[model samples]
Target chain A: MIRRFGSSQVSALLVGLVAVAAFAATYGFDPVPDGLPGLGAVEFPRLVCLLLAGMAVLLFLQESPPHDPETAPPIGRDAWMIFAACLAAVPLMATIGMLGTIAVFLVVAGRLWGETRWPLLVGVSLGMTAVIWLVFVKIFRLTLPGGWLFGG
Target chain B: MEAFLGGLAILLDPYVMLMVLLGTVLGIFVGALPGISGSTTIALLLPMTISMGPVPAICFLGAIYCAANFGGSITAIMVNAPGDPSASATALEGFKMAEKGQAGLALGMSAISSAIGGIVSIVVLIFAAPLLARAAYSFGPPEYFALALFGLSMCAAIGGDSALKNLMAAALGLLIATVGMDLTTGVERYAFGVMELSDGIGFVPVLIGLFAVGEMLDQATRRFGKPAIIALDAARVPGMAEMRKCWRSIWIGSGIGTFIGALPALGATTAALIGYNETKRWSKHQHEFGHGSIEGVAGPEAANNAAVGGSMVPTLALGIPGSATTAIILAGLIVQGVRPGPHLFTEQPTLLYAVFASMLAANIFYLVMGLTMAKFFARISLIPPAFLWPSVFALSLIGAYGPNQSMGDVWVMLAAGVVGLLFRRAGFSPAPLIMGLVLGGMVEETLKQSLLIFGDDLTGFLHRPIAMTLIVVTLAGLSWPLVARLLRGVRGARA
Candidate 1:
């Protein structure tokens, strides 16, 4: 028979492990000068890392509430698709620029989320892109990468 | 009085007043939308507010905070959906009122009670904040460190049902706060050779990712069904007789809301909940509660709106946030080069007073807006997730990128979004983490300073009367859950 751990238990253990690693890594921080020495710079992170590890242990040992549903979030295919599109915007903006990336991401995200009408998707995406450009670029005078392909 | 008058003078400026008006209108629409919260909206718009300069920016955000709580009751009354978590209690009787064809009465009363409660809390804030600031004048490093810890200790009770998870999230926040170069030692801790990380994680990107982008991802996963909504019964807006019946409930809610909101970790949601319960307990028409009692609609609406002003007190007076929105507002104030604390009363009277006056104006603005255009806002609650979430994402993208024009910030934002989702999956709240992140540096700095002052003696904390009192409270708070659990076990055995 195999014993299964719930997502909460697993997450707790993972965070605990990370806290331990974070504490160990703090050893690499630069030492405080001899003149001013109560708590060093690394002391604060170390304190928090230890607290995190302790809390993680407590969380791991804690029983799951019987009334509650499964601990894992209900991230279905569409949710992942939306996340992927958002992540892809970074590279797409680098390749095709901000406006182009917005349009592409919108169409892809819209389709994945079940917006079937091509004209509506394209029109809305275009409108969003135009609004973003006007507000971010024109009005606020903020910069988005013009893209190497767009020749700045 | 001088500061109050100066603030009114500033609020009278056309640009400042316009920002308040815009913020009130925008807050209502967003707050009436189920998924978009005031916190998310403020986060998405934070970077843009930079261009608006400090005064207008703060006023805009303040008005939004004030109006959003009242706006939430609009949807609760009409569609049985709470646009803000603070309005959940309102839905109990508010939806019943709607179903019984009394939505207009509920809507009108909610607005009226909300305005009254909000105005009452603002008056309290005007008198209370400076007094708190005066009290804080004698506080030293040790006292501040203990105070910050006391603030963090409340994390175990907030966010979600799981105390341990909330504490863990707060710890993660503290760790994140250590990312920047140490002010005293001038050594980078967590930057990992990234230049942007040396200044620490940007608050705007983290907030945008956590609230906006994170919520969008969550929204994409779930499907919601449209509930039967009641059309506005315009002819029967609450008359003076109804007001006579509800004055007691409204006052109870406002008092509870103001008290709860002023507490460090407590916020509008908690205030509204307690307000509902208390109003139910004290009402003359207790039998009418679940059957569309007008007092039921008025109580929580007033409480939640009142909580907006209540939450501002600690954020302004002590450099500690009272709620998530105020945390974001505190960040906005900091980015504008205004550090909020006891000194702000003396150093930035115009800014302080402006906040007070604008919040007062916002209550009036929303009262008028709610009474007149509630029908229009009621329809906006039905916005499809497809159109809404994507637009939010697009705006979030610009918001994260706009501040420093740094792509690194955008990447950080995306990462925070992922973390936010993971937090939800683990049944952790992002709120405690935010509070910790905001207060972490202060805790670390004050601790170090205290240590230096005490010649590295750990027992020095006991010598400071205020610090000692705060630490005692913090310890009691941290232990209460365990003690209560033990007591329950004993009682079970007795049974």
Candidate 2:
């Protein structure tokens, strides 16, 4: 017989499965040296994985109520857009440099968050990026990505 | 006494004084903004402190820590959006007071009580930390192992709604902590052939992702309804009569805050909740609760601020963080090459005392700054999220990259951000997970050493009385919820 699971249960199950995979990966560790002290590199991780899997199983068994309408609003398209933009900025930083990526990211994020005026968006995005560059890179002397394209 | 005087002199330096003032103001501004916490502020500032002297760096962070608690209450009172989770109880009564046009009075009460609480706790920390360190000086590997275990277990117990979920998150954290080369065996465990992974996951980047970026992502997804416009024209210092009325509640809350803050795992949020409840129970005007009572504002504000002092006790004496913010501070100390624990008190007595002195000065600054700026700060809640959050995101990105200058760390941050959002959605808090990761290395090393000494004999733990008692306490703490439920069930049946 097949059993249906809720979203929460499915998430728990996925976590448990991941733990099992990690547990299995521990087999590749070099065998413990003869008469060498306590449990080695693999033992503690193995134990943690076992406990994680067990707890995940228990979490899967617990029933949770469906989301209420007043709270827990559905994840909207704009939210996903913002998340994608953030994720994209990581790789973009490698190509365009920190300042360049941040300038573009701020504009895109502002637009996604419902800012309508193009001039304000452009000004704010560039202004914020410039201020951060001055403080973090110039004054503080901290290194930010210079991009492979810039000969950095 | 000389140490104390030396600490005061360090704080009084022109450069150090500037750092404290700037840190406190910045901390308040950031703390007043919804979705940013003192921990996140410290995380963002961590890399910048690398170039600073040890005394100035810690003093700066300590000023931020003390002031941020008060800063959180500003937005909580004005807009019903708590700047920190610990300020939620304050929001309940504070917002009501705002609606009734007592916003200024409520702000005054919170500021004053927070100052009182902070000062009281700093006193406790000054006296208690060295004594605790003196006691911890006798601890061997077995005792350290048991203490670490107790901390981890208590975190799981006190964190989030689900004990099982907290444990699972902590276990995941421990697993992550084991990613680098094993310190004992000198063998790579989970590096997966990546060069960066061999050095272990960078905690600073993870912290930025979890607290700052994750929060920004969560904020982007939701709708913030129109916030109340609090008029601060009437805002002023609490009158003598009002102060007289609320002093007792403030005192009691401070006491509660100090006690809870000293314990592992528990934090100001818990202290505030208990303080609020107790004040309500003992209040003569019980009807005033949830409807703009001065006592209501004073109680939780005092407690949470007092907890800052209380938490520093364990952090300095035992090298165990009492909260997520302190965990980051402890990380900052490690990055600065100053190991915290008993030796710190003995070896660097002036540094320890300097931190204490800085906190005392910060409380006075917070009171002055909070009251003087209440009018201006009340208007900050009106800032559009569209403008505010993007700036925050940019800062978070830079903050994550600042520590190691690794694009790899940035990628790790992005991944951690996604994971953090998913965990929050799944009803797991990141606090216990953080505690696990921070304490995991110490726990493993100490446990292994203890086992090596005992030759794998489980019964040998009983030879160390302190270790044995700590182990028993951990077990009892882990079982507390279940035991409480069972007792309630039996009592209900009899009824």
Candidate 3:
């Protein structure tokens, strides 16, 4: 017979499965040398994995309720958009530089988040970039990467 | 006396004081804004503080922490939006008081009681931390291991939606902590061919991602409609007569907040909640509750602010952070190469004293600011999330990179942000995971040392009295819930 699982059960099952996988991966770790009087790298992690697995199984059986904060709303399309933009910025930082990346991210994010005016987006984008340049680069003297396109 | 005087001197210095002022201003600003909390702000600013000396850096962060608790009450009172989670208790009656056109009175009570509570807790911190540190001199590896375990055991109880999920998050953190080369075996475990991972995950990046960028993503999920503004008089400070009415509750809240906050893994939010409850339990005007209750505002506001100082005790003395904000502060301490513990009091007494002084000063600053400029600070809540959050995202990316100047760290930050998003959706607290990450290395190191010293005999832990005592305490704490349940079942059967 097949059993249907709820979110909490799914969560617990996933955690237990990952812990078991990690327990399996411990074997790939090198063993402690004979003369060394200390633990192998996997000893502590291995112990933790077992504990986690045990706890997950218990949780699965218990079928606890989700502890969502009172204020938090469900993740919407906008969150995914922001997450994607954030991920895209990391690679873009190498190609387009810090300022360029910041500007691109702000404009794209602002527009996508439903801002109508181009001038306002451009203002916020450039304004933020300049403020950061002054604070981090000029006044604080922090190093920001110039990217492969422009040398710092 | 010399250390105390030296600390006061640091507070008196123009540069340090300026930074403290800046931190206080920024703290109130962000603390009065919903969706941007003090913890997130501290994480965002951590990298920028790398150039500053540790003393100023700590003072800046400390000032923000102290002021923010009070600042959170501003939004809670004005709009029923608690800018900081700690002020949720305040929002209940405070918003009612606002509806009753007693916003000024409630705001006044919150400020005065918050100042008194904050000062009381700082006084406790000043005396309590050094005494707590002295006890640490007797602790050995096994003792520390037990202490770490005791801390981890509490993770199931603190700040989370579910106990099991909190434990899972912490386990995940411990896994993350094990990514670098092992200090004992000189063997790499899970670097996965990444050079940055060889040194282990950088605390700064992880913290930035978890608190700042993660919060930004959470903010992105939905739009905030503006709450109706409650008009309040900034000049209407709580009068002497009003103070007399709330005197008992202010003290009760302060005492409870300090005591709860000193406990491992507890913080201001819990303190304020209990404070609110106890204040109701003991209040003469119980009828005033759930309406426009000035005592309600006073109790929780004081409790949360008091907790700010109380939480510092463990973070500074035991290196076990009592709250998420203190966790960030502890990370800052570590980032500045200042290892916190018993030795710190002896080695850096002046610095410790300065931190205490700055916290004291911050309490006073926010009280004055909260009372006078609250009307203005309340307006900050009106700032559009569209403008505010995008700026935060930009800064988060830069802040993540500023630490190691490596794109890899930025990549890690982004990944952690996703993890943070998942964590929120899954109903987990990031605090336990942070606690696990912070204590993971020490737990392994101490356990290894204990084993080496004991010749791999697990029973050797039985010989260390302090360690044994801590282990027993941990066992009891973890079992108490089950014991209570069993007792209840037996009683029901008998009845």
Model 1 CAPRI quality: medium
Q: Looking at model 1, what is the TM-score of chain A?
A: 0.86
After superposition, which runs of candidate 3 have C-alpha atoms over 4 Å from their true positions? A1-3, A64-75, B233-235
> Better model by lDDT, 2 or 3?
3
Task: Summing lDDT over every window of 10 consecutive residues in candidate 1 chain B, give the lowest-scoring window.
Answer: B227-236
Clashing pairs in model 1? none
Please compute DockQ, using alpha carbons, for every candidate against the native two-chain complex. 0.65, 0.65, 0.63
At residue B347, what lDDT does model 2 achieve?
98
Worst 10 residues of 2 chain A by lDDT: A64-73
Q: For candidate 3 chain B, which ten residues in a row score worst on lDDT?
A: B226-235
Count of backbone clashes, every candidate in sequence: 0, 0, 0
- List per-prediction Cα lDDT, in the order shown: 0.86, 0.85, 0.86
Query: What TM-score does prediction 1 earn?
Result: 0.96
Model 2, which residues run further than 4 Å from truth? A1-3, A33-35, A68-72, A149-151, B157-159
Kindly list the per-residue Cα lDDT of model 3 for residues B1-495, writing each as its tens digit.
799899999999998898898889888998988877778888888887888899999999999998888888889989999998999999999999999888888888988999999999999999999999999888889988998888777787777667668778878888888888899888887776778888999888888888777777877887666677887667368889899999999999999888888877778898999999999999999999998788998899889988888889988898888777888889899989998888999999999999999988888888888878989999999977777787888888888889778888888888888778767766778878888888888889999999988999989999999999999998998888889999999999999
Q: In model 2, what are the clashing residue pairs, if there are any? A: none
Task: State in Å the error of residue B108, model 2.
Answer: 0.8
> Per-residue lDDT tens digits of candidate 3, residues A38-82?
678888889999988988888778765644454467767776787
lDDT of 2 by residue, B100-204 (tens): 988999998999999999999999999999999999999988998899888788677555657777777777878888888898888788888899999999888
